[model samples]
Target: MTFEKQVVLVSGAGRGLGAAIARAFIENGAQVVVNYRRSEAQAKALVEELGQRAVAIQADVSDPLEARRLVNDAAEAFGHHVTTVVNNALGDFSFNGDAREKIQTIGWDDFLGQMDVALHGSLNLIQAAAPAMEAAGWGRIINIGTNLFQNPVVPYHDYTAAKAALLSLTRTAAGDLGPSGITVNMVSGGLLRVTDASAATPEAIFELIAQSTPLRRVTTPAEFADAVLFFASPWSRAVTGQNLVVDGGLVRD
Candidate 1:
């Protein structure tokens, strides 16, 4: 579908990869909703920079009610139905390998928290937006995931586990929603070089990842954002229930 005919709601879009995804849609002529949980300033700043095609709305996707409201608000603002969603909001997290809790030290609650936001958040958005997508006869749902689940380079147990669950939801949702013309898919990336979550990563780790990948460099948020656009664009109309890894050939699955 052409972006000009779509309204996109991107969760946690105030910064990092989310921000890049939001901008990608906007540049392609889609009206975008930059949803944020607490980054109001950053979110609003992004909207301002993008002009009227984009607007920032604060809503935590973890709550089903709020997720619905976010979609409603986006529709009202743009005077258009929301035809796309990118579930990119993350529960508080950092990619600092040195500070991550190991298998022994981490508790179930830690894993639960990640699941609550990543898995549950994706469910809430899909449930809330599916009706409109069905009515419009077209829609796209993109879930942001990680390459670590497949490679476990650092074994960020909680984060990787949560994302693994999200990947499952993406495929299952595709089956359930395909009849309505809504395609569900995932775009997984490796340790992004400059996202806020990865800001604490040591320079040596970045160098190591670059050397390990065939591309000879870590993927940038902007580059990954382009892959997300493909899923949402007309180019991928026949695709669904698939996981496209965008980590510079680090993991071949």
Candidate 2:
């Protein structure tokens, strides 16, 4: 389906990669709901910048009630049930390899934190949005993932483990929701050139990754965001339960 006919909701869209995704949807002619947990200032500013097509709403996706409210509010704002949901919200995290907790020292809580936002968060959104999508008979759910599941260059134990579970959810949800005309998929990326979470990564690592990739450059948020759009676009109507990697070929899968 064309984006102009869709109402898209992007979680954690106040800044960083989330913001880029929100901007891409608005540019593609979709009315967007920019979901944010904290970054209120940035979220409001983005809504103002995006004009009439975008609205910013604050909700913690990890909380089922809040997630449900977010979906309802989005439908109310746009006069249509959300046709697409981007599960991009993440718990507090940083990509500094040297600073990451090693498997030996990382606690279960670390994994739980990420899962709460990634896996549980996606579950909440899916449960909340599915009924409406079933009624409309069309929907798109795109979950942001990481190439680390394949390469694990930095071995971010907690983050990688949580995202792996999210990939599993993406696939199973696709199966369960496909009959209702809803497709679920994932877009995974390697170390992004720059984002609030990745800002702590050493420049040397970025350069090394760029040199290793076939593109000889790091992936930008805008570039990754475009892959997400493909799933929501009519071009990928038959695609589901798939993970498209947008890391400049860093992880060939």
Candidate 3:
């Protein structure tokens, strides 16, 4: 319980990878904000399951105004200045009713929307969380990223582009906040099989990734969450602006 009593806000935590990340923080004794956009029932259920340490809030992080509210709500819930922020939210991909939008067919609005959630959404949270971290003289900002951006196996251009932009923002934020004891880093992973959000990925693609990876296993949400916790921990005090890939050596970045 190294993080006992600490406050952590995780966006898009109603299900999938986001939910897993929230659980990890709670297990580590951090008071967690389980943020979601539409899954109210799931969010409330999670909060009850986690007991008093968890608070479920609703916000569409892709919208900058709502993004700010998520942070404020978490700080109020935890009854402390937040010390950790996990920008793990993403937009829903309908993509004009196609299975997936190709680069040529993808519209600029779709691309910007994804970027808004990954890059601008991250920035919004960071801006809201930074003042408190600076006041405390310490903080952690962990950005969730995709291994596909490192090397696209399926070629989801819009999602990949947004994640790449997030990586760029992570480094720059680290540079800006280093003197204040706040560390910003990214946790990039290959296809995660356990997350609900990833369940739509074809099984063949997952098998191919497993074969390609050095460990011959797909990275789990919990495994990816562990890497995120490391970056947020005191042990990584001297570390910042680094993309810690947790995909079992599939793509090193």
Candidate 4:
């Protein structure tokens, strides 16, 4: 349950759920690599706030070359191989139901756009970090997923489909990397209370979702981040290829 010796990398750690995950790892004693694509100011601010234990690195994880560079730079910055990776980076998206693209209107490009960041991005990071992890005889790869594919609460076709594919990758990769001591898993969450991507969601929708969950509340980024910590911690060493839903019990499987 301790991360004192772990060097962790969290993609899109400049803000929202990614940032919260970075903070959680830092609090738990892990040296964190705050990976961001465009939020330079926010990322640097976070690194400064987290002090020496955290360093911000920019890379668009969908590209294999950039992804590899991110992993290499992270190790160089922290003087340790990255022992854990949180694939929380996301393509530009918003959670407005009314503004969503319906099945009839959504094009293939829409789905590809989301997949570029969710599925391909995760694959790139995993491939880049796996060798070091194998050499070290241990690694944790946690992919950020969505409850929408399971519940289809709002039927976000593009985003949900991409996450569903990511869940598949998690399982298959887990099986492939198991012998090398690298565990791959997923953490799926419902419409988070207020991430930049979820900000467009109306308050009424949030209230409705909260009322449906057993906890009678929307899950916060920090609360969901705690579950990510579990997957990265020693307690989950025996667990892999599993998807843990942290949406306040809205979608039970």
Candidate 5:
């Protein structure tokens, strides 16, 4: 459970679950790189709070060049060695009425937008970071996913499909990198109550979810972040290509 002497990178870490993950790593003695797109102020404040162990860098993961550049910047920050990579960034949450048109009216563009961030962005980061992690002979890759893909109670088609692809990618990457001692896994959770991305979900819906879960409460960013840490820690050395869901028993599959 100790991240001492580890260097970790969390994409889209300026706020929400990403930010929580970044803070957790920093608090555990890991040098953290907080990747963000437009939250410069938030990122800077986080860096300041985390002191010298944290760095705030702006990079859009969906863009291949920026994704690679972010890895390069992180390498320079820590002399070409990073042991952990967390793919937690997403393009946008268009669910809950953000769509101007229903699926019958919306083009495939909506789905691709979601796919680009998780699939494309994750592949880019894995490619950029794999070499270094392999050289170190120890690495951790945690892909963020959603439990909605399992339940589909609300039918967020685009988002659920994107997450499914990410889950598959996690397994494939684990298989490919297993020999190199790099473990790739996914942490899927039900709707988190406080993330800005989930803010659009109606309070009534969240209440229903809380009531359905055995825990009687919606998941929190901190709780999900702990799962990320588990996948990153030495304790999970033999576990790879696995999707560990933390949805308060709401999604048992």
Candidate 6:
């Protein structure tokens, strides 16, 4: 239950679930590198609040070069190879059902955009961090995912498809990196109650979701983020290639 001395790199950690995850890791005694693509102000504020244990680095995980530089910069700044990576960066997206494009109307480009960020971005970070992780002989890679691919209550075609693909990569990466003591897993959550991305959702929709879920309330970023810590901690040393859903028992996987 302790990250003690572990250096964690949390992508898109400037705000929302990513920010909550970063804070949780820092609170648990890990030095965290908060990576952000455009949320520089928020990231800097988070780093300031977390003190010297945290540093904010700007990087678009979808770009291989930026991803490499991010890992390199984190190692240089922390004076240690990053021991844990949280691939939580997401492209521009919102949960407003009214605004989402229907499958028939959405072109391949829409799906590709999500893939570029969720799947390819994860691949980029994994590749950049692999060498250092291998050298250390112990590492954790946690991919943030969504339960929508399973339930698809709103049928967000592009977003769900992208996360589904990420799940595949999580398994494949785990298979390849297991021998090196590097475990890859996914933490999937249902519609989070509050996040910048989910802010546009209507209040009525939230109430409906809360009534249907077993917990009687939608999950929060902080609640869902705790699962990420379990994967990174020693308690899950033997766990890998698994997806843990954190959706107030809404969707059982």
Q: Residue-pair clashes per candidate, as listed?
A: 0, 0, 0, 0, 0, 0
lDDT of 3 by residue, 1-253 (tens): 1578569889888888888898898898889999898999999999898889999999888777897788788777767888899999888753221377777787888888888788888888899889999998889999998777668756478888999999999999999999998999998887787677777777777788799888998888888899988987878888899988889899865
Candidate 1 ranges beyond 4 A from true positions: none
| Per-residue accuracy of model 1 over 31-69 as CA lDDT, tens digit each | 999999999999999999999899999998999999999
What is the descending lDDT order? 2, 4, 1, 6, 5, 3
Each model's lDDT? 0.94, 0.96, 0.85, 0.94, 0.88, 0.93
lDDT of 4 by residue, 1-253 (tens): 3599999999989999999999999998999999999999999999999989999999999999999999999999988889999999999998998998888899999899999999999999999999999998899999999988889978589999999999999999999999999999999999897889899999999999999999999999999999999999989999999999999999998
Off by over 4 Å in 5: 94-102
- In angstroms, how far off is 172's CA in candidate 2? 0.5
> Model 3: which residue pairs collide?
none
The worst-scoring run of ten residues by lDDT in candidate 1 lies at 147-156
- Where does the lowest 10-residue lDDT sum fall in candidate 4? 147-156
Candidate 2 per-residue C-alpha lDDT over 33-140 given as tens digits, one digit per residue, 9 for 90 to 100: 999999999999999999999999999999999999999999999899999999999999999989988888999999999999999999999999999999999999
Which candidate model has the greater lDDT, 4 or 6?
A: 4
Error of 2 at 63 (Å): 0.6
Model 4 clashes, total count: 0
Which candidate number has the best lDDT?
2
Please list the Cα RMSD from the true structure of every candidate, rounded to 1 decimal place. 0.7, 0.6, 2.1, 0.8, 1.6, 1.0
**How far is 123's C-alpha from truth in model 3 (Å)?**
0.8
C-alpha positional error of residue 173 in candidate 2 after TM-score superposition, expressed in Å: 0.5
Give the poorly placed runs of model 2, Cα more than 4 Å off.
Answer: none
| Residue 30 displacement in candidate 3 (angstroms) | 0.7
The TM-score obtained by model 2 is 0.99
Model 5 CA RMSD to the hidden true structure, in angstroms: 1.6
By TM-score, the better pick of 3 and 4 is 4
